[model samples]
Target: MLRKNILLYFLYIVSSIILLFGLGYTKNWENKDIIVGFIFLGCYIFGTKYRFTSIILLVTFSVLSFYFPTGIIYGKPTEAILISLIQTNKLEVIGYLMAIKYEIFLSVLFIIIQFLIYQITKKEKNKFKYFTIFAFIFLYIVSLFGISVNHHGINRNAFLKNSIDSWKVIRKQKEEQRINLGDSSAIKIDGKIDNNDDTEIRVVIIGESVRRDYMSVYGYPNNTTPFLNSAKGIFIDGLVSAGPNTQLSLTRTLFKAIPTENKIHWGINVVSLANKAGYETYWISNQGANGWGDDVFYNLSKLATQNKFLKAGDFNSGNNDDEEMLPILEKIINSNAKEKVIFMHMIGSHEPVCSRIGNFTPNFKLHNEAGCYAATIEKLDLFIEKITKILKGKKYKLMYFSDHGLSVEKTEVFHNNNIVEEYEVPLFYLDSDIKEQIHIKKKISGLNLLDIFSSFINIKSNVTDSNYNFHQASKITDNSDPIIYWDEYRPFSTIQKKQPPIKDIQSNIIGDTVKLENNYKFSKECVSYVDSVDVAFPLNKEVYKIYGWAAADKDKKPLDEAIGVFIMKNNQIYFIQGDKQARNGVRDHFNISPGERDDYGIVSFVDKKYVDSIKNTYLGYKDQYNQYHICIRNNQF
Candidate 1:
């Protein structure tokens, strides 16, 4: 019996080690994870004599351990998971279960093994003293403190606490907003309107998760925004959004909040201001209305003269494209109301990009995922064109801007927490009457959008700051003023210090020198090369050049071999590629070419005339082999 017990104990330890290592390998092995594993292991071993308690504790720990890795791997935070749990329907839950069927099976198997080991050791005497229990509890408390205070590692306990706190704060804010909704005195409009009979029609378009760097009009290599490029408007180049997420960004942008103000009362929004201005306000949105209960934006939409929500369900429900709101928009436009303001909120380029594109054909040649994203952009461009056509003869001014931007890192695109790219969105103003195409050079914040709107319709509002109004002022009052971005996890009331300018590989150029390095490994089974050089072809004029190469041993390579030149001239990006075969594919989708290349035996060069057009350029390259190499030289070519 003693020998049998010894064998069982050995198996249990071995199994535990195997499980820990397996999980560590699957998830990235972190020191914090190791510490957590040991803590759990000690509890399991000490509690083995108490069979039932041991089984329960081990099972719970195992489940949590599995979920921790899963959540981290998928980039799902505790708050997001909680939201999904509360909001997801039974069918959706079942679908999720089906998707993780293998993981569920593994978890069950692990639990059973632990149970059997505990059952086998049940007859043994309760060797562990009360001190073992005390020690376990003490260590667990210490671990919790370490997790909460350190903040460097992935701590599930800390994450759950933060998530719970965030939810509580949201609930409190929602309650406050609900109370504010009833307070008529909370919203004050100190604006005078010149009641002109010309019927000024103004449309504020709110785009979703659209990065400025991805649009062709903003100088993206692909012609994803042909219609926008041709449209006559004021293109504000450096308008950073207030936040990375939609809810946070829109709340701040649409409301009248000063830089130093902390508490923002709901109901006093753009819609309320427009309503007070005697303009027939319309709120047309393709985003779901029922998902967010008592959300400030949803409640504020109630203030509109006419409000229409095309999508009734949450994100799990069907996605109705932005184009679906067009018919409703036409109805609103045809209404006989004088001096109107329409807020057209679009479901533009949301994640799961393929679903957003629906049946639209892709206009850019890329990998399947990237192609889907590009297709959505093209679809949005077309939607804008259609709207412009409808308002052709009317006296209207349309302002288009995204609520927030997304980030594309290492070819995987998603919403980043506090990256500059996540807040950098496109802002353009197109008017039937104003023909001059102007570009604002200074950095601006979306927080001042309310002022810009007031200036657009010539409404005299106390909130209107002439210095911040793009339509009224050509330049910013203070060019050095910092554009603030909020930390993702913090409360909306807390103010984060202004982030310093993000130094991209291309933007960090010094004089006639171009030097950058990109060590992004695409895959393990490929050979890749990246090289860049700065040249003064005309001796006095400077130009930059870059080259990329990739080759796989097998025919089915993960990435294609490509070479391109990226030019930043006058705050616009110009991309020129080298290979004609590659250009053919690109042109098929974008309808633009990189210009003819001067083909060398093993290397290719872009046309000198095109190169001469760009005064500055930067280059970087990465391939499927997970290899990123970059080099920059000053007047060496």
Candidate 2:
């Protein structure tokens, strides 16, 4: 009876697990997934005394369902998903959650089933009597230390290890900041220095999140780069960036990047090299450090003689415009240093685009994110134009290049580096001596940034002189080397090729921006506010964002496109078509179906643009049938 009962109990436990964990995967099961699933099973079966651990594991596995991939835990240093999660800001986290709400819903249900199985197997505690406490300890030891040794950053135990390793990178980078990077002997680099007898200035403008295909100068339909389009310079075509993200790309671009199996060795950087060559270097930036403070750009920024970080946080919030550093630029340019190398890091365009626009406003009507993207490049053009004014009559050589380009897809525009557009960035150099624009017929890799920059600055070195000669552009312009893909570090050409299409934004915003004074009228019965308007900032007399529930009252069915936000600016009508955004009270107020979307919620950025133009702005909306109706409780603020 004892032998028969034991066999039955063992069968029950096996059957319960097969039923619970098996149902989670409907089809194709990966080996890694099965291994992870079994690991969880082992923990639950062994910990009979602590049966409640199953509840904790259920939550953990559910979260890991979203995170567990081949590369996240044990991938390349900066490109790991875990590293990205650590680097992300609050707004980015919010945006990503909203984008993947459906995936999150499914993951919750999967892990709950595993928790229920623990209750079913609770009566099997008698099975644990044969095994001593040492068995449980041995099982946990193998799971923790043994798995961690095999999979340093991939296993469950190695998650903490990966996070700690990332911070170690941060700590290691912080240590680099302590050294006198500006001192020539500190770096101990072998390079020839030419002390210019006359006054001279060297400017390196590092642009943010800009792709070559999006620029007007590069045949883009939009006039996003009007100033650069006419500017006389050595423009290189098909210039690939070092890496996709700022840290990975710039660490390799600005510094001597050696990608070893263990880690990326950030050797002597260009700023330190410049310092070694006897140039008074200054790093003035509108770009923020990695995760508010980390290895991101802080390591390279510290190498300069004089450095100042402009943006306070991740540079995802507010307007951290390039113009903010212009005052400092003027100070540096007018300084008594005979030879100066100024590195200006501009926040050209980071993700969540609307926040970055200072002088240039986002035209939401013509593609919200794309318009903001174009505006950032336009702002950069104006910045360069202003820079030319600052350096007027001064002996100066200017060079500009972006850290990396953004993804072409609208939904996820950041650098996972899965597309060709992500690597396609701008690289150019111009000096007072150049009379006409000389487009380098051949392509080049941005990994050669150190060499190209050194050559442009007339740095006497065998590396620079051998690879490129700025003066003799025609015969010896064969510096085109192959670039490697991000993370993979394989030949970039081997990856799938995808070129971004020309996204022609608002024609006016692209060309000379002039507001159309449209005579758009609104009838009083269109939109109704509940109480006083829910203007975001009422205290400072700033009324930009107005929130209220709107509906296609005439239409029986609420198509998402039926609702809209109408703005009357300069006595002209501008309407932004509605998309699905949920407000808690919207469905209840409208008495809509649970299956139907919450289309009634309305929001607009009327004050996102020039404040004076929006001074007399009246907020209203037009329904799908072109019937214009004004809000009864209108924006009187």
Candidate 3:
């Protein structure tokens, strides 16, 4: 009887664990399902003859369920089930729903174990079965730890870590303020009140992945940025980056806490600071509104006199064009308002670079990386020009910068190839006739954009102690002394500073940028480089960092693995290796110039085999870093 009951208890544990694993697959977890499963198991285990063993099994299963991933713990099971059921047929829905029922059925099986345990171990207190209960506890802890370790940024543990750190910083700042002032704590970041200028407006356009490297207005080969080049404003060159990802880059850009001296991860956002300054704050975005302080942004927008927080699409599958967002802009500009800071967050050249615009093939003559990017930039440029023209007489000072630079290619993964082109971004400030009246002071970087709000407003206010909220704008373009972060596998700032001139010329020549039906000129250097490493190249560097490409290589041939070279000329990124330069070279793909050979180089052609073979090599550091290094043969080419 005791043996039968123990077996039944063990079976229950196994079934519950299987259910837990299946539930975790949804990526979103529901607490209610676990509870239901637990209740069913408890009911079944009560029938076991070894009553103590049955009770212990029931408790262990219940406790283990609580250790579900954060998302599962926070999410609603019913809602998840309903969502999963959407668009499914009756039979499919029944099958899916049947799985949930089976979880309960397995729990009932525990009752058979309890009956047997009671019959066999009736004379005993069931001391041996307690070990299994302890095992469950240990397994729960180990399993959770393993899950957290495997998943870096998105883990509940990591999010909690950041949140707790932010709260601690906020508390410490509050204490410091009290010590400084007995009566009241003044806003530290915000300066003295200036009543001199009543009518002031600022338009901040935050571009997504708009690097200066490919901008025609900035002297690229193509005429991508014709509008910006002709426009009237001060074009600031040599803008540097604080980090790569959007959350880190945007947090540094918006929060006031100085990111130059130390890294600030958690702080009150600049939007809140702007609100306290009595200026109308508005956030118009072309992306999801809920990521890192989205709640804070929403709250600030609500406090403002006018709030227009438009999400271009839904949380999951809804798709909206960036250009289509112009309708909302037209309304905001035409509306009645005074002293407003309008933040326009554009999806300016974000990838699936091809899907940014509706038409896959807008122009027949246009094809290739530069051309595709040029098309997108041209579209955005036209939009900007139109917006500037509309705000003709409006009192506004416009500051435009990208969240972070994106590697020019879609297939190119960040962090996989640590290159300057992946990190370098564009920064520009355009002041309309109205903004000229208020003289701007202090040298500002996008890194300090969030922290400098009080300074931007030129008013009195409280500054939050949270560094996460403070924009690390001051570090923008501070390449002389570059700041490194987790995502950057190896330091890349040095690459931007060093490298020879011959590499620069070699990088400039365009390779097979676009292989259209029409003929296009292929650079001689690109052809020669691809030919040399087509079959054999000796590996000199086991692991290395890629800088930039001399040119782009779009050739559809597999080339031998070669070390990617990095060089900076006139403060922009360029790549070259030995006598050959990468024409369509992608940093994420071992800086391999685009082309073909038996042995594919760093950047290979995407196909069924390529997609199927894809796998992550290195482990990410803290805070969700995907950047990695590569093994390269360097002695021969």
Estimate every model's Cα lDDT from 0 to 1. 0.56, 0.56, 0.42
Candidate 1 matches the true fold with a TM-score of 0.63
Q: What is the lDDT of residue 525 in candidate 1?
A: 51
lDDT tens readout by residue for model 1, 141-160: 43333344465643454334
User: Candidate 3, TM-score vs. the true structure?
Assistant: 0.48
Winning candidate number (TM-score): 2
Tens-digit per-residue lDDT, 87-110, candidate 2: 444434443454343333233433
- Which tens-of-lDDT digit does each residue in 405-443 have in candidate 3? 554532221121135664566666565642222212222
Q: Report per-prediction Cα RMSD to one decimal.
A: 14.9, 10.3, 17.6
List runs of model 2 lying over 4 Å from the truth: 1-37, 44-52, 55-127, 130-199, 260-267, 289-296, 312-319, 361-365, 410-412, 462-466, 469-481, 497-499, 507-637
Q: What local lDDT score does residue 89 receive in model 1, on the 0 to 100 scale?
A: 31
- How do these models rank on lDDT, best leading? 1, 2, 3
Error of 2 at 230 (Å): 1.2
Candidate 3 weakest ten by summed lDDT? 613-622
Model 3 regions more than 4 Å off = 1-200, 257-267, 291-304, 312-317, 359-364, 410-417, 434-446, 451-479, 487-637
